[model samples]
Each structure stands twice: as structure tokens, then as C-alpha cells.
Target: MVAKKREWRSGRRSVATKLVQMTRHLVVCEGTETEPRYFGGMKDALGPANGRKIAVVVRGSGRHTLDLFEHAEELCRIAPDPYNHVWLIFDKDDFPSNEFDLVERKCGEVSSSSCTFHALYSNPCFEIWPLLHLRYTTAPMDASSCQKGLVDALKREFNVEYRKNMDGLFSLVDSRRQDAISNVDKLDKHHKSIGNDRPSTMNPSTRVGDIFEELGPYLDKGD
Candidate 1:
């Protein structure tokens, strides 16, 4: 006897065809704040051009790189459906001295076979946004020092109280990111105990298909 082919049903349509038709696209930011600071407000900035919705998911603040890795497979499953076009942004301090590789590995591990990945790097963390702002704007300010220029710009753009608040918040949040790295000793112990990488929920080679395999019934059935 011939094995029956699995068929999915949608209203008056085959679900498998709809799934195949879905456009896969996304702009995934490493940290929560970088996207808003850079691309969120700018309409048509890096527009998909393929008529796909622009979805942005934060991997948490700069501190959540490892956490993001742990949940990478889950993230791929949760991403916008169908088509797979993604841009993964990373900060220079992601793995202290290896941000590029970290971002690359993460994207590779979680991305579907249909998805394409782009990795962009920013140095010293989300401070990349501030650096970019300084590079393009002078207003009689010095661009020789990106950090100093950013500080000066922040001081001038906002009132004294707001400036202080911004600095304090940025520093406080950034410290948490720094702490995430500093706490690696504990992570090492946890990894050794589990006989696997610590803090990350899945191995670096885990694929999006692994997670979606569990969602076979719930997924849309269309091309």
C-alpha cells in the first residue's frame, strides 16, 4: 500500500502551500536598545523592499548574549514565519574580544536553512550608536573621540538632570552586561557539572528545525 501524504487544511486552501508561500524576513538586534536608537525611528532605513514585515526581537540587554544562545533555537522558532531574511547585529564587547564569532555562531546555530544572515559589529557595546551619531554630526563638536563626543552631545542635547539620568542609566545597565561576563567562573562550574556549555539552553549547533519539529501541527500549512 502507498503511504498517504500528509495534508494540512486552511480555509478552502492547503496549509502546506501557504507555509511555502510565507515570506521569511527579520531584523534581529543583539541588545534591546540598539535597534530603537538606530533603526527604529528611521522609516525606510534598511527597508526589507520585499514587502515583509520588519520584526525586531531583543536578545536582552548587552548582558544576555549567553542567555540568548541558550534560547537561540527557541528564538528561531518564535521568529516571524515563512520567509527567512535576517540581519543579526552584535556589539564589540559581546564575548569580550570575540563579538564577531559569537554573533556568527549564534546566527548560524539558530537560523533556518532558508534564512540568510548578516552580522554587523559595534564596538564597546551599544555605544556604537553614539559613535555613529558623532561621526556624522559635528555642530562644532570634536569627533576625534567618539565616546567624549557622545558624552558632550548628550550633555548638550538634554538638560542637566536628563543628562545625568541618561549617563547613570547607561552606566548601570552597561555594568550588568559587564557583570555577565565577569560571572563566567560560575558559568564554567555549571557547565562542568552538566557536562555541557553553561547558561545557554541549547548547544551552539542546535538548528531552528529542532524546535519547529515540535510545532509541526501548529504551523501554518501554505506555500
Candidate 2:
């Protein structure tokens, strides 16, 4: 006997064909303040473009990198509708190399199923990614220097002191969005030419712009 396929009905119309699918995103950040405020604004600034409502769920629970990864997994487990993508943002400020490597591996493992769990990481701090928005610099700096430069630049350009929980932070650097992405790519190339094998360890380096660009399709056109 042949098996019949079950139909999903939505008031007489097939639900699958009648409704547009939106890509749900779960983004857990290591920073409870800075990352959420920035990414939340980024999410809020988007609209349903290309028939995709890019929804980003930013979780800021003061979790570390590994814990953040686990949090994203937990979200996927608990959410009735699994997210299309799960992103764990990380800052390798003082984290050990083992932890960093382990987190990356765990994300890789979790990404094998339906959901794609991505690890978006910054070298020293998340501030470095935002600092690239202000100016292009590849100078090697530690965590403290990165934070100081970011704070100073924000104060000078926007006339606002760098606060972790500042709302609408994405708008402040929205105009230079492309520039920030360009700077990140340029910095990576610069590092490669200089014999720096580990770009992530290169101070002021980040793949945050990559995630931004992925979400940019829905962002730039609408806002």
C-alpha cells in the first residue's frame, strides 16, 4: 500500500505554500551589555526584505564563550520553532586558547543538524569591531588598548562616552557600515601578508562584520 502525505491546512489553503517563511536567528553574546545593545539595534533596524524577516534574538546573560554557545543550543532545544541560524558572539580577551578552540569545535558539532550554529568572534574585544567603523587601523593592541581606543574614538566622533549598555549603538555607526566591513577585510589581508597565521589573535581583528553582512541583505534596503 502506498502511504499518503499529510497536508498542512491553513483555512483551506495549504500552509506551506500560502505563507512566507522568515529566517529566525538566535544570537548569544559573551558581553551582556555592549554586544546586545549593538546587535539589538541592528535587528530592530531591519524589515522584511526579499520575503525574509530576519529576526535576531540577542541573549545577554553575562555568559562566557562556551556558555554562550551552550545557551544558543539550549535556545534551539527550547524554541518551538527552531531557529534557522544560531550565532554565538565571542571576545577572546583573556580566554585561553583551549577554550577558544573548544568553543569553535562545539559550534561546528552543533551546526551539523538543521540549525547552523555560527561562532562570530572578535580578537581582543567587541569594541574592536566598532572601532573599525570609526577608522581603519591594524596596529597591534592588547585588550586594554583596544577598549581605550574605542572609547576615545566614540567620545571624539559621536561626542558620547563609550558605555556598555548604550542603546541604538548600531545607528551611530550605520552610515559607515560598509566602511567597517571593508576595514575588517583589509586588516585580515594585511595580517596575512605580514606572516600572521592566526588572524583572530591579531589585535583588533574580528569576524563580526561577516555576520553583519549576512544580515545586511535585510538591513540596508529597508533602513
Q: List the residue pairs that clash in candidate 2.
A: none
- Candidate 1: TM-score? 0.41
Tell me the tens digit of each residue's lDDT in model 1 across 1-223. Answer: 9966555332443434443243444445556663434334222232442244333333433434444444444556665464355545444442533434476567666566777554444433444244332233312221134446556655664432222113243332322322333333333454466675421221111121221222222222211
Q: By how many angstroms RMSD does model 1 differ from the true structure?
A: 15.5
Residue 137 error, candidate 1, Å: 13
Q: What's the true lDDT of residue 22 in model 2? A: 76
Candidate 2: where is the Cα deviation over 4 Å?
1-18, 47-52
The per-residue C-alpha lDDT of model 2 at residue 202 equals: 66
RMSD after Cα superposition, model 2:
5.6
Q: How many angstroms is residue 31 displaced in model 2 relative to the true structure, after the best TM-score fit?
A: 1.6
Report how far off residue 151 is in candidate 2 (Å): 1.9
Could you tell me how far off, in angstroms, the CA of residue 30 lies in candidate 2 after the best superposition? Answer: 0.8
Question: Model 2 Cα displacement at 148 (Å)?
Answer: 1.4
